[model samples]
Target: MENNMFCFQCEQTLGGKGCTRHGICGKSPEVAGLQDLLIHMLRGVGFYGQKALEKGRKIDQDTNKFVIDAIFSTLTNVNFDPERFVQYIEKAAEIKAYMKELAGEIDGVIPAAAEYTPPMTREEMLKEAKKFGVMADTSLNEDIRSLRELLTYGMKGMGAYGHHAHILGRMDDTVSHFFYKGLAATIDNSLSVDDLVKLNMEFGQVNFKCMELLDRANTETYGHPVPTEVLITKKKGPFIVVSGHDLKDLKQLLEQTEGKGINIYTHGEMLPTHAYPELKKYPHLVGNFGGAWQDQQKEFDGLPGAILMTTNCLQKPRDSYKDRIFTSSIVGFPDTAHIKEIDGIKDFSPIIEKALELGGWQEDEEDQKILVGFGHNTVLGVADKVIDAVKSGAIRHFFLIGGCDGAKPGRNYYTEFAEKAPEDTIILTLACGKFRFNKKEFGTIGELPRLLDMGQCNDAYSAIKVAVALSEAFECSVNELPLSLILSWYEQKAVCILLTLLSLGIKNIHLGPSLPAFVSPNVLQVLVDNFNITPISNVEADMSAILEAAATA
Candidate 1:
């Protein structure tokens, strides 16, 4: 095993370089090594499966779900279980063998262009991984390296959304086809920087499809989000805090715990769950428990309830709550008990018993309230009012301050940016990033709320829908509308969403808390020149610049 790991996929990458010692997200070098091997085997499966597809053999549904989970598992802060990766590698190898059989039925077996070969044992895979980590694939052409990394990161984000949707009985073959295409592209170094950049843009298109699929799954299952006020304070009685963006788990928890004298509350991206009509109908679904995922350690500390993590942005557990933390789906922490589902039946009794034993706060100690659930349907419901407001000069500019919220430095800029927006401007925010300022009062502009909280990060598709509809209403390009996208990036989801925006030719996107470490100078220059992307600086300064630009346009 290597002494250090190299990962630069998220906002907290070390010094805008790679994390060469331990992961900023709490993954060890050994865990990172296994993830590399997992990806290597997946690409091999992709190469063979893709060839089989070309010969008219359809990949099975189980293989599609397996590939989605396998890619998403390697995302930052998602899975830290080395043994879990070992299992995923073994499963991927089995798929590779199946793919080989399928390929054999075709024109004969085609050799893998890359040096990696499927390992028979976990130990062999771990050893071979050392020679094939992200660092080992490093190219002297920084621009090419950067583009390749962008494609891989975007796929991880796409896989996360795909995995969630798959779990809920929805899967798209188009998404699966490109999943293999993107993975296969990662191992092809003969492709030039230009070739990789072109593929990176395609990642945006595929990611949009994946996001759209997840959006359909969520809206159809949970009902489209509407304006609703959620309690920021905890309520009395025993409760369970459900975090991450998995609504299916939340639904099941609410079902299993109904009338059992336990309360359920949303945390982080789960906060918007309050707006869904189906989930909101449950009487025991209480208020939110904390701020963003980054502050969970302090917010969760000493809180007398069980916390269930359904997805990523999971930090290392604090000693105070580590014992009570529960994981489901692809999320894993070494010693914590995981709630597993067998054939759609997830047993959550451990979480229920934990809450019952610990109990929650004695009484409601806080009274803060935040408004959310302004999904595209809700926003477009009042499109005429919004259009009239802009036409009547009641709304001057629209600033979109959204993306993942992280514990890293300079994230405070988002809080300040939202705080300093002019009274007439409508701030549209989504994802975990909304936690930065959701608790604060921005007041309303006429009939509209000053800040609109569209669902989770996947809800960026809703934002795009609203944006495109607004463009059609005004008879202008989306960029020509009175809008600006000031976004913050943390994980691969943001990467895929950014690429989607670029694919749409939406320009002048202000991106921060910092530019991606994977994007080299030359590649960034291309991004700036093509997309007119700007890095965020002082809030007041960036705000002034965007406002002035909007006015001049």
Candidate 2:
């Protein structure tokens, strides 16, 4: 079998056309098709599953887990293993069959698509897609249809995050139901672009709830995040750098390495773990090791520590460190060591042992601390002071310059936008994309730091909390405040966050690095007409636009 595969679900694909032979991320055609089938089936399951639940039907955890995991499995650079995806396909079929059994007359299953096989014909694949809720067939308007598709993609992203949270015993019924609702809505022909726009906001509303639930699960289990500095340089010896968003995996790693003398460091989204009281309590938890997800090939190569990926935002691994990488839960890389579930808890002793055998830096190296731990609690803790700063006119503007980063060079717009921000502004950042500006010292305004790090992508919840708090303090809506959201997106997680923002009725958001490949023209118009969603211009132009709008208003 050839080692390469093809996929085009992400914004950057071969030729802006469908990937035919091998995906940029190294996925083969088999894996790509399987991932599509998995997503198509998820839509079907979500359609029937939501209806079943509404009728007071109770769905089992396995069925729920399957739906969640299946979506997460399709994210960029997340799943590269064909065997694992094949299993997911089987699992999806199982769930669909189970739901059909329960419902007696399932509406979303397309018979021709249900029995399709791999190395499948394009015709067969297209027929199978018909079963996936039909992409808002009732909406004749292109804009409405496009927006519906965009919203659907966003829900898929949110569902993926929600699923990760669910695996750790954190389940939100509202979030789960929305997945069903959104799918069912796709099948509803009466939905207008206006209706879809409203649903778009609901996507955000549900995502907000989902984020809160995950936040509660994380803080409750790990304790609230606290401010702490992380080290950037790698120390020689045996160590493992854990990245992405799964604290459960981090906790397990910590427990396994308690007395083993292997050092642990958080990378990317995991950087904020330093703020959590419980996870931070570990002495061996050393510091942060790398930058954003896109920089992983350079960061992880020739490193002394093993790399553990817990969730999405995973990049293609470089050959240098490929053998040393491990993935757990829904993440899968071809041929890498996958941490399998054992007795409901994954034992990461292999990663730990590898770290010990590698023998990290022998001599104590110069340690540096990078500040993190500013999740919602950390921000809320200082909300009163933040409110004061804004009231006193000390913090002139609040710029939320965070979202997914892509390979596009134009994405440097985020860095420039932040760089060109007014002196009195404060920057709130989250997700992997923040790496572009995170290392830059923007100094401070008044007593507050100009750049405030808000943990991982899910920590967008923190930004909302702060925004709502500001709104309450000022006796105005969130839109009334002197805040602007300049987002850079490349994946589905960003989709859900945008939906959550819309749900809050927050408008005039500037999104860039191009919109989703899936959104049709009609949908783009709806987003622009209703939400004031605009593409990112040059940094200077965007900054001026943001500031000019504030000044004029």
Candidate 3:
């Protein structure tokens, strides 16, 4: 109830206010304060890096990577260890040190962000953390506060994409350059609301490229996704369940465990990996084991296999499964055994042995399959059919109803909205949010299933590409087409995607389970006036409005 350590980075931030004393995701105030400090220092690093870039000077490659990783540290439920943030804070300052020499002194006046003192120990970092709370500010105006926080939140989302793409050894210099630009702008008080608002849109544009980079990284590594039915039930054997969005980790784990008498299944965002040609080639790479990430604690209870988290969306692992849990990438819990890569090799032997020890459901379980892997290529492969169906009145409209899933009350709205759609309509979904309605059969519109699963959240890029192609075929802009976007968001990645839609001038988006706490009323009005982003209330009313609006259009 107290706003001692303020954070609204997630949908479940306490009471739709701030995670004052602690986080709803089981984060402690100590860790919350440190996260805020880490972000503040990251902006400080951005200030110098961006200033250098302005004078035809270059940003250090390490600076580019550190800024992305530091920003990602602030993502909800990613890192709970206070020590990680402490290290991140010191690392940010270290990047700033190199950036300062590159930038030199600016006009004899050092920007406040350019100021940095390298901490020799943890105590110094803690003392600095006392001063960098999210609410701590130079100006007390609420509008500026809102806009600044909004920019930072948007960049947080952008940073997450950059981090994911970087993991695949894919780096976009253009998108990477803007990371510092956006971060530096957040620390600059001279920028007006208009400036911040414009930067917000640019963040969206860069995020589109960032998401595009990740999509490229994925598709090139694994083949383009095909419409494969992923089994939801676990099969019998010693097994390992991979979670999160990292396909590389999944592929490596699958390869390592192949011929080793172990079964590997996917959990959460890893469901779509079943369709990746390179990953599916390994026979031990079996099926998907559970629903969304939010249900892991319940679904994993007494589960015999090991669980490896590749990225964020990790809940506090329950003690029941914590011993069997392993983590990679930026995800961390205090006692979990983490798999780190040495040169390009990650040793998954620990997870393998643990799975063998616990064994698995020894009896073959009946597998209930969930349809996924309908990426842009697969959908557009049938473009002629889809186009003819739309023109002939067999398919009237398409709904893009997908984003991150979470443990919130209004999430059921997604399930209800998907179920209540007209039979002639096509429902396109992605990300963990698909779990809500994925198992339910939407039948088909001619040869196509009414509900199309377009892989994970990053595959929103595929959805965007599909929409653009659809627009080209119909000779109309995206808004002119009979497509409606109903999105459900939880974390920073969702923020980036929403900004992407807004940047593309996509309008009339119905966003829920709730409006972002980071979006101020003025910013919300700006979104409404410029992009017509609406918050969802009643599913029946919203669906009727969408249908009625499309009918008129």
Candidate 4:
């Protein structure tokens, strides 16, 4: 049978392979096709945008922001509305036309992506979209397609980080320019495997810079995150549960709902907001609501409060709570209320009103608190103590085990891995994947907690910073510092973070629940040979291997 759509960008793609008919994340084939067309349109914009940059002509920040947002919208579980993608396609065409005019004369052969025009109607758009899907080019080499998709997915993750920084009034020219360069490279047939590999590495470096820029934007704007304990139990009253990774949206919602009798509870990545001094000051900002994004349908069923999804990690809403869910920023779902910014400010009044009408829970749940807010600033602040513990053999090893979580089986490996880790080891975790064992009791080593909760996935910046600091203090390279990265990947953000680690020459990283389907055997071999990246094994064997390796080292 012929396939209707093709997507394998996320870790949970159907059968450890491509999702041909529909997405495992609940996106319909029509939405998948539209997302493909949207990506295709962005590449067209990138062609002209790259040419404009070569001619020393400036691409406006508006165009840069649009490209970043459009790319971000294509990441797993971000936007699922076909109509919204149609609008983005239209806008991308306009941006491409403007860029073409600005780029002036072309010096060499033009790629087909640069010359293609989007169709007019939704029906025509869907038909045209099918031809531009990932499987569109049958003649392209499989390895080349693998590398191209790898680079593109990395850029998609970089775009998510860039968008977060952009929202906070931060911009980096190097990061912005690479988006155009990398996007155009995907279509440049003259580039060989080695050339694409080099580009992928180059993207890695740029993505590190992007992640760093976002780190600064978050820390500088909100004041560096400090250690704070957050309440996980819900309270009685009108409340709104904010999900995703947008701190600015959370800050705005906190401000708008102040003293309005509506409490705000964070869900998913937003759980770290409690550590930011500026955001946590609001009395109405209460506690965290649910676990990871994968459990939303079960956790949110018949929820009393409203839900505001600021960015990605949005599953299709269940009928139980669909009416009360609100989407902001680039997140969109059909038949949901959307909050748009006016004058660079989001009005969450719709969500606020929805919560007021729902009236929240009747009685407060029993209080349960968990530790968070151990960002780079907090961890590095006590660097001397950590170093001292390592020297004293109180902390024998460090395990960095975290990434995107999913509903797939074998994820219990992380829980058991962390559980079986020796008492002398420290587990540094971040991202939604930590939800698996964040609530577990891992006893402290001296004054330090055995498990540290870093910030959101973008806060991989924090983990990297802490590692570099440790390496410097111990007088060893990061890879030789008795640390191991066992990551659980789900989407494009994880792809870029993994690239950033590989670009830094870090080795012996373990990845699962399953390897990305888009990574061909040759590309996978390149990673294994160059970086020693390995697929995760069973918890007992992997743990014993890591411990033995550390003991010998």
Candidate 5:
């Protein structure tokens, strides 16, 4: 290991160990330490926020903003600038201190912000900083360990989404407190696996609320997403491809370039934006660009247009088109065009000008098209057909092949799972994980595509909506339906999504490529007993087990 700071909070860590020297991400130890400190401060704010809400003191927008910023600031590939990140930490500290002061005032015990500067070393903080009571360390058995880590990673992703929605004026203290309290819990050593299992479900429960808040924030601002086919072609003129997981940033780009000739194409998690009624209304919005996040270096090399990243899943850009990349919100690159917020609006003029300067493909080319828009609304709209298909054996099985992406070779399991899916089976995918097999044509049963890409990871809300709708149509519980959730997790967003599924009592979810670093054995048993959660095996074997179980059930 290189003699510098190292942190591996993401799935693609160096050599499956904590990244040292520099990350595959090109992030240095200094920035990694700052990111860790930022998370610590956010936890403090979340903890303090919980106390304030408990005392009947309402959390103001500033408190909410600080919390959200703190969470998002730590996301993968977002903020690599230590100076700016520390500014966010200091800002968060100030907000947390103010909230503490307010809480004290409410209780008639006036106090000052914790007048303490963090000891200026990563080793010290990692060693002695107060641990959140909720972490499930590596002391447990493998199965439980996996789930605990799974939940924590998902919370991290959910925190990012929650923070973004907060910026849009959407507030959910119930959800916010969960992060603080949950992180605090993960650090508890005495808690049994059963305790962790229950807490894991709560993470999902709150995540569901968070996703709903985001859904409402988005649909209300944009419109309830409708089923619209997105074109996946490179236009004959100048354009820009916007990727990552932020819809607000996408919307801002749409607003900023309303009449400009530059067309906007969705990439990665942004692919589902086409389903949004408001965003799709723009004719300038083209189609999806390349595949998943992991494929960007190849897909983006010497691209004909500029790229705008709103959030995570950014790999190091190759020199071929590195300069064309622009980042906003928490997404940052060393020298990429940073679209700063000006008067509450993100000005994307630089990217737009760049797009025009470098005109896209010279001639309009015929690009292959794949069907999207199979989100919750679209899926539920065809609920009757799906039910009939299930009953009639047109669609024999339903596989929810959703989760995160990773560099592990074992991830081929997802591809094999999707590929080996029975012709009559339906695959519902979300997040960047779907990229493994989404490119293959699965054909459709009538108008429904066999492979339905649910929006982003947060759009797991769509999967739940479809499941519940199907259940209602069949007059059965979700677990009683012929659905199997085979999840691939890599980060915190997946945690929140898994929690949402568990909170709904959906069971028999098969998770992979590996379990989380948290989770105790007792907790694993609790989840297995209650939800029947299990780790994934070979695709064929897992498929056989699922099909056999469905046949017997």
Candidate 6:
């Protein structure tokens, strides 16, 4: 069959290859094409932005924010509306024009992507989009193409972190400038494989800073995450279930819904919000609702309360609850209610009214709670105990089994690996992947629970911090420590996190359920040779091998 659109940026792409027709996340070919076009225009912006930077011109904060949000919207399952992408393409053209004017008298050659004008009409834009997708430049070598896509996807993830940070009033010029440079590199034919590899690593380093910036923004704005127990059961009242990874949006909603007789519950990535002191202070901020984002359609169907999606990981809403679902902050879907920010504040009163209309659950269910808020501050606050446990062999091994979760078959490896881990091991988890075995009772090793739930995926910074601290105390490199990262990746955010790990010279990361299709065999070999990156084989074999390696080391 002829290909309609090509995208392999996510782990759950069709057949573990490209999504040639429609996205597995319910995005149509038309929407995918428009997203491709939008990315192309953003590259044009980046190209000019780079030239401006070389001329000692500072790119304004507005352009930086626009680029961040635009790139973030192209992430898998973030925005699937074709019209919204068209709007973004138009804005990108405007920004590219502004950047081009700001960057005059360029010295070097300009690529076609830097100077092309976008088509005016939607049909023409869609037609134009087909020429700029993943397979657009077939003349490049397969390995180079793979590396470029890898870098582009990494930047997409960086943009996501940058967007969240920007939302919280945090800005970093170095991080913003790297976005332009990295995006430009994807189209720079003069860059060699080595140059691209170095750029990828540099981008990874910068992304680590970006993640740190986001961590600071979250903690400073909401206060450091404490070890708080979050109730997961339903309560009898009008309620709103907030999903995705935006704490600011959830905070605003909590403020808006205060005393309005609507309780707020978190879903997916937002479950960690309950750990924040500023957010958890709200009396009506009750608990978490569902598990990960992949199960939202079934989880939200016929639900009593309204649902708010603050960021990505949005699937196509089912008809049963589409009317009650709302999108905000760069997440969009056709025909769904979107809460737009007016005067720098999002009015979630629509969602509030919808919740009141629905009347929520009829009766309070039995209370069930899950523990969260084990961020760097929380974990490191008790570092002496953790160090003592390690020294005494009370904690024999440390397993960081976390990343993006998906519906693919092999993801069961993460659950089994966590379940079968020896009693002496400490499992550190983050992101929605924790939903796999979070509810399982893993008894404590001393005072700390065996399964430590570090905040969200971006909170991987927390895990890194703890690892570096442990390595410091043990007088060894992070790799030399008895730690293993068996991660499950589903999207670009996970890609950037993995890059951060590889850039830190951290080794022997077991990533699955499948490797990214965009990673050509040659590029994959580079990763394996340099970082000892391995694909997860089976729960038993991988676990045994990891334990044996730790034991011998």
lDDT by residue for model 5 (1-553), tens = 1245555556556666556677666677666666656655665565556566667777766666656666766666666765677577667667867866765644332212233345444455433333311221335465544554555566777768787687677887787667656654543445666677677777788888888888788778877666566676677888889988777788888988888888889998888888888788888888888788878888889998999988887777789998898878777767767888877788888999999998888987686676666767667777778787888888888999988887767899999999999988889988888888877889888777788887788888878888888888888999988899989877667666777787888888998887653444655677689888999989878899889988998
Regions more than 4 Å wrong, model 5: 1-8, 14-17, 20-25, 105-116, 119-152, 183-197, 519-526
Candidate 4 on 1-553: residue-level lDDT in tens? 1347899999889999889887889989888988989899888888889999999999889999999999999999999888999999999999999999999999999999999999999889988887888889999999999999999999999999999999999999999999999999999999999999888888988999999999999988998888888999978899999999999999988989988999899999998889999898887888898899999999999999999999999999999999999999999999988999989998887888899999999988899999999999999999999999989889999999999999999999999999999998999999999999999999899989999999899999899999999999989999889899999999999999998998888999999989999999999999999999989999989888988998998
TM-score, candidate 2, is 0.90
Clashes of 2: 22
Model 3, 261-365: lDDT tens per residue?
998888888888888888877888778888898898898887888989998778888888989999987888887898888987899999999999998887886
Model 3 C-alpha lDDT versus the unseen true structure:
0.84
Error of model 3, residue 420, in angstroms? 0.7
Please give, for residues 62-104, the per-residue lDDT of candidate 2 as tens digits.
6776676777777777788877876776667677667756655
C-alpha RMSD (angstroms) for model 6: 1.1
Please identify model 1 stretches exceeding 4 Å from their true place: 105-123, 138-140
All candidates: TM-score? 0.97, 0.90, 0.97, 0.99, 0.88, 0.99
CA RMSD, predictions in order: 1.7, 3.6, 1.7, 1.1, 4.0, 1.1
Candidate 1, run of 10 with poorest lDDT: 106-115
Q: Higher lDDT: candidate 2 or 5?
A: 2
Model 3, poorest ten-residue lDDT window?
Answer: 109-118
How many clashing pairs per prediction, in order?
Answer: 0, 22, 0, 0, 24, 0
Better of 1 and 2 by lDDT: 1
Please give the lDDT score at residue 236 for candidate 6: 96
